[model samples]
Target: MRLTRGGKQNAKGAGQEMGGPDKEKLVPPAEGTAVPNGEETAVPKAAEPGPVTEEDRTRSEEGKSAGEGGQEETALAQEDGQRRPDESSLRSQLEAVQAELKSALDQAKEFEERAASLQAERDEWAEKAKIAYEQFLRARSDLDGFRKRTERDLEDRINRGKADLILALLEVLDNFDRALEAAQKTGSAQAEGVQGAYASADSSASGQALQSFIRGVQMIRRQFFETLAREGVEEIPSPVGKPMDPSLHDAVAAQEGGGEHGTVVAELRKGYLYKGMVLRPTRVKVIR
Candidate 1:
């Protein structure tokens, strides 16, 4: 090892003082040997560390900070990598739940629409049923009224027929009463004549009374015929001297006569026609 500049100068001075021949050249101390100052030395002081500068100290501090920052960044990156798949799975599950909720809402709306349609149909059918019931009630009422009217009309017709029959019989009773009055007058005149006992006068008065009775009978007959005509009854024409008609004449006897055969000789009973139909045929004698 080489000695320091200061150590070399000291050795040169010592050598000169010792009266050595090589005074200009100085020998270095051996490694780890004792120097003349009683201090052990291994190498020259020139090989020792130099004084630290501000720039160097600053650079060392910056390097240590950069290393610590790099380690922290690496740890954060590893933690992020480990959590990525869990975040993706959570997002997917949330989307699926949203889709299911949307579908359920759609189904509920459809069901509400169907229920509204069914309610409308039910109301329409109820209206139709109400109309049908009203129609049935009206029809029943009309039928009942018709039946009542028919019965009333039938009863009225029967009552009118009975009235007509009674009227006809009353006409006959009136005529009979008139006939009885005339007969009573004739009997009273005959009794007076018989009580007086005058033969000639009695005969004349009796003839006059008989003629009056005959006139009354003829008047009654004419009045009866008028009543029958008013009731739509008419006498058939006399069949005497006419050909016998089986529809109008009923032959009661036959006689040999100067007239043609099958001819009516005399009418025994009067025939009547009511409304152009035969009510009674005439009883007649026909010529054989």
Candidate 2:
């Protein structure tokens, strides 16, 4: 096999050592002659340089790879020494970021809890307002009812008072009627029994006085009836000569008379109505 210059030198040095022969004492044997015992063979001259073989190319690649590997190892060691402080700085930055994140999380949790508490308070206030509104509605309804009832009661009391007062006044009216009838009868009888012109004149003067009194009484009755009319009190129609109605008249007595059966003959006492209600029933005599 062919070798490079360095490989050839190493091989020559090894051959010299193994041959144990000095180059000066070595002799070339003649052609076709046998060598003597213990004599070494002649060393041939080295061949000339030749084209590179596959083995030579492979060995050169191995040497270049070894040199590149050593350079890479040295660069890696330098990088490790330079990166120590940078790695420590990065670690500090990471720790600060983690602390900030933890603080933010805690604040968010506190805010969430506060928001929940506020919502609960709002709901409580809303419920209170709703209850108050319902109570107000109930109170308003009750007040309206009470007002209406009070008005009704006051109206009833007023009507009842008016009826009682008017009934008392009716008795006085009856007395006035009786007094006028008696006075008229007395005047007529006295006139019928008069004997002389002088007595007739005296009777006429007395009649004038009686007529004045009767006109005064009539004026008073007319005023009283006007006042009662203003207070919603009205006299019922006379039932005399008509069929007696139970609603308007009470039969005080029954008599045989020149009238239809169950017909009212006379009204003993006048009846009155107050505000469309019967205040008093007429007392009448009915024909049997």
Candidate 3:
């Protein structure tokens, strides 16, 4: 092989260093001469690679392709690594959102339960109020009835007091009537009895005086009866021939008379009725 001038000089210098022949004395070998084995001079030379072959070229191309493939694979791996972090962050966000949604749902359920409880309490109070109101109404009605009854009782008591006074007066009037009847039976001849201060009531002092006193008593009795009648007090009928009623008549005595049995034989005493009710029953004798 042809060498450059600088390369030849370097080879000669390396041969001198190993104590070999100089570069100028080195000649070409004789034709067909047998080169000695161990006596040949050594020449130091730089190591060189061998000539490139077709197979080596093919191997170089394949290696270049493989290197490019490795670079692409590394790039793809880096991209995947970058995307993994973002995906992880998104997953964490999704989990947080789901947890928040579940917590919110739970709180809502609790609020619903509380609302229902409050509603139940309100309904219970409403029921109690209704009961109290009904009781109050009933009490008010009872009070009203009691008040009316008390008013009626007070009125009845006042009327009974008036009736008692009238009844007392009627007893006095009854005594007066009996006195008048006895005086009439005495023939009005005793003028000394009724003509006390007024000795000359009329011209004839014997008959006129007592007769005038009797007329005055009769007028007083008539006035008393008219006043009693005006006040809704009336005497009960006690006819002798009528049937005796136990409700209106008190049978003081029973007698065997000619009339029908259980019939009124005689009216012993009169009765007074203030209203439709029996104030006093008529005293009568019934025929047995």
Candidate 4:
């Protein structure tokens, strides 16, 4: 087998290699020199005067970045210092606004409390007024009822008292009627004897005395009736052959008489009227 040689310098264990020539070493041509084949060679960069390590390059770049950051921070601090008074004024204004808001809230709460208290008081007074009004209504109703009842009772009492007095007077009138009837019957019988005796010559003392007694009884009966009339007492007419009035007449007996049916045949007892009202009914006989 044949082995090919790659370079003129013999490399030792792939660590070092010899460059091709001065052209490969990157040497710049002179400024006025013409380039070979119309192609210009690349200009070589100037070599660092001191050999800089990787760590030193990194350190320098970091220092340059730090300086630029510091300058920016200083400018920001200067601007913040210039605006410090304005920031403080804004803070004070905010605090004042908060205080005003708190004061307004407190006033509103106080107003609400006052309104609630007034509402409660109004409710209480309204309830009292309602109760009083109800009581007044009840009292008025009771007064009306009482007045009506009292009037009714007074009328009834007056009527009863009148009735009692009239009844007592009726007893007296009845007795007088009975006495007058007896005296009239006696005088009539004696009158015939007196007339016969007086026609012949003179009347007897007993006959004259009896006639005088009858006249006196008649006058007393007439006087009693006149007094009753003055006291608003009147007779309810219950004549025979007259129409029977159930309101003023009570039928004591039904008989066939000289009158139409349902007519007053005879009045047995008298009836009285007082103030246009029937005080007593007439007891009468009715025709059947």
Residue runs of model 1 more than 4 Å from their true location after superposition: 1-199
Cα-based lDDT for every prediction: 0.73, 0.83, 0.78, 0.76
Name the runs in model 4 displaced over 4 angstroms. Answer: 1-105, 154-158, 184-197, 200-233, 274-277
Candidate order (lDDT): 2, 3, 4, 1
| Predicted candidate 1 versus true structure: per-residue lDDT over 21-44, tens digit per residue | 342233476677658787444442
Give TM-scores for every candidate, taking all chains together and pairing residue i with residue i. 0.36, 0.61, 0.52, 0.51
lDDT (0-100) at residue 145 of candidate 1?
93
Worst 10 residues of 4 by lDDT: 1-10
The C-alpha RMSD in Å for every predicted model, in order, reads: 16.5, 10.5, 12.8, 14.5
Which candidate number maximizes TM-score? 2
Model 3, 1-288: lDDT tens per residue? 434344455555555666665343434455676678735444444433234445555666677788899999999999999999999999999999999999999999999999999999999999999999999999999999999999999979977987888778778878877978876876444544555675655435557556777888889888988988887888998668999888889999997768789999888778878866666778898889
Q: Candidate 4 lDDT, tens digit per residue, 1-288?
A: 111132111222122323322232345678889888967578645322233345555556666677888998999899999899899999999999999999999999999999999999999999999999999999999999999999989977887788779878887887887887887787777667667434443446666787788788788878987987887789887567888888889999998766689888778888899868888889899888
For model 2 the TM-score comes to: 0.61
After superposition, which runs of candidate 2 have C-alpha atoms over 4 Å from their true positions?
Answer: 1-53, 63-116, 147-151, 154-159, 187-199, 256-261
Q: Candidates sorted by TM-score, descending order?
A: 2, 3, 4, 1
Q: Candidate 2: what lDDT?
A: 0.83
What TM-score does model 3 achieve against the real structure?
0.52
Q: Give model 4's TM-score versus the native structure.
A: 0.51
Residue 83 lDDT in candidate 4: 93
